[model samples]
Target: MSKAVKCLILLAVIALFFVTELIPLAITAMGGAIACGLLGLIPAKQVFSGLSNSTVVLFAGMFVVGGAMFYTGLAQFIGNKVVSAVGTGENSLMFGLMTVGTVLSAFLSNTGTAACLLPVCLGICASAKIPASRQLMPLAFACGWGGIITMVGTPPNIIAAGALSNVGLPSFGF
Candidate 1:
């Protein structure tokens, strides 16, 4: 079969597996990648090339930092301060949470920012008697917006910068 046809079939299978969720998404993705390499659709080296990408390294480092913050109760301390500063009104609380999420995500991965702030957001919601549903979506949207504010804020931005450099175009600067 042509490589393109093989790739299409592989993508279809991966999509089916993802929708069914019979196996972990990570496993399904990895398995599909390996199958492509084994089928000669992609180079073996290329298949794992992203493992060592700088963006991946950055993500790993940020995950560790976020985990440390959670373990040291720093996240909770910050959460408390933010909640107290904003008071119990739902609009004020939502605005504060989104602003924090956006600011943190501008310097760190959105996933890391969300992870670090999730418990704090939950605590604030519970303590203030605000339903989590009202604030979490805003927090998520703010994180996404934050990613566009800096070159290193998200993997897609980093990847796009790399692609530009590969094509002999100047990369974006912070």
Candidate 2:
């Protein structure tokens, strides 16, 4: 088969597996990438190169930290405090989560804030008997919005400020 057609067929199979979920998502994803390498669609060496990127490393570190929080019971403690303060209702919990996420992301890297908070949110959702999906998506959005609030919260803000200063314009502070 032509490379393009073969690649498309592979993509279709992967998409089907993802939608049907017959196999675990991560396994299916990895399998698809490996298949691409075996099929000569991409260099075998490059198939896993994305995993070594800085962003991936940062995420891996954050996940480890989050896991540590859960293992240490910190997530449960924080979840308890949040549950008591916010109450168990879905709307209140969501509002509280988004507010906290926004405040944190305004002062910290959005990705870092989200990664650190993910386990806590999961714990909170579990204790509240709510699906993590309902709150997690909104929390992610809040973090992104918060990153726009401060120059140091995200790289784009710093880059934009630097560009302005290089052009002899006043740059934003804080």
Candidate 3:
């Protein structure tokens, strides 16, 4: 096929993947980037730009900072403080976890927020006699939405921030 045809085919295929929700969005995007390079739709450097970009560095730094927060017991302390303030009942427990996930995801990694809350979530589930499977998905969804509340919550947001900045827009602070 021609280059334009390849581009169209690629776009259609990727769009279909997204519309079907068959894989994670980021994974689909990465696959598209790789295919672009392999099919000569873009230069190799462009395909690999995601790795070397400053936004990627920012994301890595955020993840490291998140690890530091956990290692220093900051997340646990925050969780405990919230639980203490709210007083633990089943409703309050879930609300507290969701609240923490939302607040932290505004400034930290979504995955990191999930990681930080995993043990605590399990404890809540066990204590409340709630199924881990039932509650985990809601927490995950909350974290994902929370991550969008700020630019640094996830890599895609960072990437979007960077792209907008490149076009002379204002920087999005975490």
Candidate 4:
């Protein structure tokens, strides 16, 4: 068959997979790569190469470092001191949430930072008789926005930093 025909077939198969929803996303991803290999769409080696990409390694390393910080109770200690000084009003809570998100994202994934603080924000909402869904979004959004200010703040930033490093630009120094 022609390359165009094979491409169309692959596209149809992917669309069908989505429509049918029979396979888990992980399985679908792997199976898609395998299918491409079997169909000779690209070399199998190319498909697996991304698994060892430098960016992936950097991400895993940062997460482990962040986990160590959490495991040592350093994060909790700092949070306690800051919260004590700042008070637990809505603005304080918002700033706390945003700062936590920013600092944590500097050493962890932004999504991970958000997931970590979500419970705390919810607790504040419960105790203060406020709606959690409202306050937490701004806090989370601010963290997400603030993450752009540093290299290690988010995976995309890390990747950008790495790309800059490749071209001799100074890194954001984490």
Candidate 5:
């Protein structure tokens, strides 16, 4: 088969695996990368290079820390404190969550900030007798809005800066 057609077939299989989740997502993803290398779609050495990226490490670390916070009940504790401080009204809850999410996302990865705060928001929602669905969308929107505030706030921002520098333009600061 032509390489392009083979690559497309491989991609389709990966997408199917991702959607169906018959295998663990990480394993499926890694398997897909290895398959591409074995199929001669890409140089083998480049297949794992993405794992060494700083952004990947940052995200992995954040997820580990977030999981630790949830396991230790720190997220619950913080949620209780926020609920007490802000009161349980829907507007109040949204304001508190969005403010926190925006600030956190402005300084950290938006995805990481959202992941870390999800448990805290869930805790807050549960105690307030509110549906988690009500608050979750606002939290995501807050993170999206905040992610544009700084150069390092999201992967897209970093990529944009890199693109600019690659084209001989000045990169964004901070």
Candidate 6:
């Protein structure tokens, strides 16, 4: 079989595995990359090169930092203050969650912001008797929208800046 066909088949299997919850998504991703390498669809070196990229390093650092905030109870403390300030009304709670998520995502990785705030949002939901489903979507949407406010807020912004620089245009600052 052609290498492309083999790669496609491997991807399909990976998707099936992901849908079936047969293995962790991380493992499935790594295994799919390995399979592509073994099938000669992508070089092994190229597949592994992503691990050393600065973007990957930044993502890992942000994830650790977010986790540290939670571990140190800083997240809880900040969340409690925000919740108390906003009161227990459903609209107030939703506004508080979106505002916090947006502000954090503007300065940090969106995923990292979401990770840091997920527990906080859940706690507020539990305490206020608000449905988690109602608040989580607004939080996520706010994060996405807020990431567009700064050049470093999302990967696509960085990629666009890099592309501009490659063409001798001024890169985005801050």
| Model 3 weakest 10-residue run by lDDT | 85-94
Model 4, 4-84: lDDT tens digits are 799789878877887788887777777777878788888978877776878888778867876776688766675566567
Give a tens-digit lDDT track for model 5, residues 44-114: 99999888876577667656765776689866776777788899999999988998889778877788788
| lDDT at 91, model 3 | 68
Pairs with steric clashes in candidate 3: none
Best prediction by lDDT: 1
lDDT of 3 by residue, 1-174 (tens): 799999999999999999998999989989999999999999988998768888778878988888898789886687578668766676676677778888888788898888778877786667667677765776787788999998888878888778889999886775
Flag the better candidate by lDDT, 2 or 6: 6
lDDT of 6 by residue, 1-174 (tens): 887788788989999989997999999999888887878898878878778766677667767777787889988997898788998788898898899888878877786788678889999899988899889999998888878888757788867886788799998868
What is the C-alpha local distance difference test score of each model?
0.86, 0.82, 0.82, 0.73, 0.85, 0.83
RMSD, one per candidate, in order? 2.5, 7.1, 5.4, 3.4, 2.7, 2.9
TM-score of 1: 0.81
> Candidate 4, which ten residues in sequence have the lowest lDDT sum?
74-83
List the candidate 3 regions with Cα displacement exceeding 4 Å: 1-52, 127-130, 168-174
List, residue by residue over 1-174, the lDDT tens digit for candidate 1: 788998899899999999999899999989988998999988898988888877788778877877887899877887887878888899999999998899888978887787678778988999899999888889989988997899877888888988998899999968
**Superposition error at 106 for model 1 (Å):** 1.0
Q: List the candidates' TM-scores in order.
A: 0.81, 0.56, 0.64, 0.75, 0.78, 0.77
Off by over 4 Å in 6: 89-93, 125-137, 165-169
Instruction: State residue 144's C-alpha deviation in candidate 3, in Å.
Output: 1.4
Best by TM-score: 1
- Enumerate clash totals for all models, in the order shown: 0, 0, 0, 0, 0, 0
Error of 4 at 15 (Å): 4.8
